[model samples]
Target: MAWLDKLKALFNFELNAPLINITKNSGNSNLGKEYVNSGEKIDILFDNLSKEKQEKLKLILKEKVEEGSKLLEEKSFGLLRELINFQRTKGEDKKVLDFFQNLIPKEDFEALESSLYLRRRFQEKRDVSKLKEDIRTRFGDRGKNISNLCTAGYFENFLMPLFNSSKEGFDNIYNVVVSRSPMAIFVHSAMGEDQITRDIKTGLEVSKKYGIKFLHIHGIGDQNIRTIKRCIYENKELFNYYDKEIFENNGIIIVELIL
Candidate 1:
């Protein structure tokens, strides 16, 4: 009971996990903090749970989220098709087609337009077939990943600091996405059952209470990872990053928690 109370306190009595510094940063930092909370790991950022068990909150199944995503894509394409048709009927004015440029890539918009014009089902592949077919390491160009989700909410909160910038010190990343929308990280890749809290306050409470700066991480595959290697090349301070393995490689599930 005492340990549980301590855990509760570390979890911030009652609330979803806050960014808790490294939890958002996502690396061995949370692992140490989780252990310091000696604590635990679950999901961070996207799904903040664990604190819910006290009064309780049920996590939505990743499958359900996937199903919903599929449905949305379907509906979105259907509407897109009708609008594309409307644009064709209008001829010289391509307002509908022009509008989509803001939402999707030029190639995707062209493909969708072609599919609509041909009265064919536009194939949508979420796996990012274009980026790389079997990349052992993933980047957040599209699909769900922490590297991309780090762009959410307050941009400066984690991004600027991670990039080693207050007023664009390391890179003018702010300008990179000035007009771009934030990428989405799906639920399937978010949390695992064995992990503890992804709640923000809980992670901060653990580190704040325990006081940790230097973090630890396991599993290294490259002599220099693409992201890190780039930083090293420029001799810039490395930006903190997080990853969790959803699968070992056999299945579609593969997300690696860096810590």
Candidate 2:
């Protein structure tokens, strides 16, 4: 026990480092492996660490469990299972979960659900003409093209909240409105003038109504652009006034577009 205490003290300094790699035969390697492999069921591993390290690691693990519990409450058990499976397959490491969970917040998960629903609506809505007619009647044709409208699964999930309110269902309205625009007609390269022009046009419309502008800083593929153009051409009424030249000057480079 005295030797174990001495060993713990010797490696105690590594606890706070950004990363600590332990080999199988390193002083505390066996203990580390034991804790990780024990189904997170063993409490003895905590006894080997210094008080400070124990407290820090405990807080981290507790946070992970709490996050898992929250996911379970939301009925996102698949995600919870994925997390556990990842731990089981990769060898249980509290640090990995700690880092990953920190990257994703609860709001992000909820937004993902909203985006999914919006995308599904886009696919299911059959009467393109009626949808465009309805929108033009409400918002007026600010050069929007209906056919080119498509919902961005991930991007919309993240940026929707910044410009719209949840209570008013602004995100849903915005998604519907944007999908029908000519700018939605192409996947503009973030740096390409074509994409920038579309984004600027959309931003202007959004700003005029909501007093907020959404800058599309990312670039997309030519294939996607072609697809959007095809969608727009099919629904001319939705894109009658879309401007093409304005975005060329303002489009950001592709590298700069990632969040």
Candidate 3:
């Protein structure tokens, strides 16, 4: 009976192996082929099976992929924690801490941090009345909805320009909103620089020239926080020099949203 149980577990493990492979080799060139092959094989194997059996396999695959993604995210968080340990005393450390705090369970903190980041980065004083009006009109009274709408507009107008210089501009922005309290979001353009450094430099330059404040929401994922923080801290001089207009305008604030 023990041997049978062990064999059953192994069979279940084999059934879920594709998801582990996908997570481990997400960006590999062969990933597309693997996905295609897996789907095709499943289709072929289930061709004569009952409809319920086919549906079960499909659901299983879906669940595995979702579980694998969660695992990847947890791994990423672990890496970020490791990176934080190395930069114990930097202001970036505080920023990272504040960012996570807002992201964990505090929706209000997330909203406030997001608002302050935008206000500081744009060097534009947020007219709370105007913002409130806009929020009411566009998103009603829900804080998450308001944050999503505002952040989307903010990324499109400010960050998108830095990445795409053509008069026509970028294609579209894709955003993933994580937590509300620390109000975290990730923005990506299909056409922007592959490297984060290049993207930051471009953003910094544009912000400096226009006297705009460039509010960075946070790093891509947990793994990136340390590197992103270190880069920003090390290049403080360059950031300040380019953003002199922001300084002149008194547009520097690292938001600590307490909610």
Over 4 Å off, model 1: 1-143, 146-151, 154-157, 160-190, 196-259
- Give the alpha carbon lDDT tens digit for every residue of 93-190 in model 3: 24533533533345544453444343333334433444444434543434544354344444344333533464233222112122221122233222
Clashes of each: 27, 13, 12
Per-residue lDDT tens digits of candidate 1, residues 1-259? 3433443454454434431121334354554343223233233332333455323222222333444532234346555756666565845224434544454455434443443333221123233322222121332232222222321222234333544434443233332232221121122222332221222223333333323222211111232132223332343222124333333222222122333
**Candidate 2 residue lDDT tens string, 148-239:** 22243223332344333453555434444444432232343233445444554565565446533232322334544444445445545534
lDDT for 151 in candidate 2 is 40
Candidates in descending lDDT order = 3, 2, 1
Model 2 scores a C-alpha lDDT of 0.38
